[model samples]
Target: MKFNWMFLFTFLALTDLANAQFSSGNQFFIGANTTVSIHGLVLRPTFNNTVWSNKVLTRSPDAIVGEPTASIQQVHTFNEPTSFSGLVGLTYLTGNLNGNTEDDLQIAYFNPDEKYVTTTGSTVDKTIHFVSKNFTGFNNSFLRITATNANSVLPVTLVSFKALKEGEQAQLAWSTSDEINSDYFEVQRSAEGKIWNAIGKVQAAGDSKAERTYTFTDNSPANGQNLYRLKMVDFDGTYTHSKIVVLDFESNMMVSFYPNPLTEKLLIQADDWNEVKSVELVTKQGNVIPMNNSKAGSDPGSREYDFRKYPVGTYYIKVTRQDGGIRTQQVVKM
Candidate 1:
């Protein structure tokens, strides 16, 4: 799915306030720094999580519409099948549409009978729990939160989270606009996305209305693709996991040497010749061959050596790159 934070926020900042309670169209846009916009909806900066509801049951031309006597309804389509228990730090804010009426927001499978309800107080901030199975298929299953009346408004929102890899390290970063009774964040890692193990922990900002950024680096990330998520805990011992992100890493030492069973000379080839700083040849007995110093004298990749002077036996050719990468290959010297 395309992650357009700029588009998401820009629309959030400029949409009309009248019908802003629902999503931009019929889709629920979740994940980092994302917001939903509707015509005439004005969202306060402190109240950023918003989504426009899709069309109601009456087959209206617009994606979302309201009738004075009807209940507010909409379905949020997931880009892919999403796990119900994987959503974390989920909260919502009703737009300035419904004036003084307190509405109950309910979320569940499309069946409507099976759902969780959170009543909206005078304040617009509300939390809804998604604890069912995965929401699969193209709009077959959805994020449906029903409002008591046409004016009732609720849109789900979340904090921003990101993961990036540098060298062998994985850096995790996330930001929150507000935190309530939060305890700490446990950084979890997995070779596969299913089973997770806690690797590190970072303290949260606790209860704060101000936005805060957090970062943690995994110094010992496993080889190949590594999946990471956050286990955000509350002081009450309750916790939720952040979305999973994957980081891919490969070793830097890669090179090839020809004439393995050498009769006269040895040649080396590498992707970046400039990166190959030096080369050395040594006997299987750990004795260094002094004559191999000229192997990487000037041209590193196409470097050649006259090994005819050396007696034929098992020898190891070591290649060192400028980035501290080293690799050794064995050659039989005749």
Candidate 2:
């Protein structure tokens, strides 16, 4: 994350071209880290020796050097000293900065020098001035350089997460290095591992210039081993998905009863039953009917239910654990 001042100088020299007669000096600092500033000055001669054009480039630590093809705007100028001061802003493509390391930020400018001299302060008060000699056929160009710790601003590293357990319900967690322009994080869980579905979502801290942490809890998980991943979305509609994590849970404890084509009442049971918390009766086509609920530490035994209230058909029985475990069985009401 250390700032490279030399690179900034080089980038600016190549970008700002203010006619064929201007040249800019290297950047100089003006304050402590608490209020640091960068200053660069460029002086160019007017069509005649009577007037000289000057530019003073100033930037803060958070300023971004835009693309090479960007246009420069003139903010203010001093006629006698041939100096100009203005705010420069540019937008670069996602992967164009700093050799594509996700850490490089630079702005460049080309200049032409006629007979202008540029100098920066040797101490704090980081100021630079441009002076031009009164001469004919003289012109000068200027470019300004400013830079900061690259790592402190860019978000390039990815966050990762893994699934630890799966069954009717699952648990999920993830981590990240930095987040920039991020909108939110989506938690996706899948029962088959191949087909993913959004089980839940957590809002992101959005455009953070530092490392960030995030987590999401999924209340509804599918039976058996479940797969989990994070889908990071940006405000600009861009997104990336994190690595997958898988957690497996035992399903043998599940109970199923079936005549499949039943008409009236259904039967349900759990082998060596110890305790059951809740049971859900679902039709073969996926309709759910509440069956019964028991207090914790309740004994598990054969259970029967009247389906007279429900149309004759096959159904599924689901048992849930207070600890978030689940077991399912098919039943028929005939």
Residue-pair clashes per candidate, as listed?
14, 40
- Candidate number with greatest lDDT: 1
Model 1 reaches what TM-score against the true structure?
0.34
Looking at model 2, which ten-residue stretch has the lowest summed lDDT?
29-38
Ten residues in sequence with the least summed lDDT for candidate 1: 57-66
lDDT of 1 by residue, 1-334 (tens): 3336556556644642323443234654344333323221211211223333343221111112222322233233232222222211112234322332333322222222222223322223334321111222233322332333323322111256777878778888998653656789998886534467989999987877566899999999876546677888878787767656656564476677776887988777777867876676655334445434445523455667788788866676666567655565667877
Q: What RMSD, rounded to one decimal, does every model reach?
A: 20.9, 21.5
Q: Name the runs in model 2 displaced over 4 angstroms.
A: 1-156, 166-169, 251-334
Q: Give TM per candidate.
A: 0.34, 0.33
| lDDT over C-alpha atoms for residue 39 of model 1 | 28
Residues 167-277 of candidate 2 have per-residue lDDT tens digits of 455656665554545688888765433467887788888755455666666666555545566778877777766655555565656564534555654555566455556
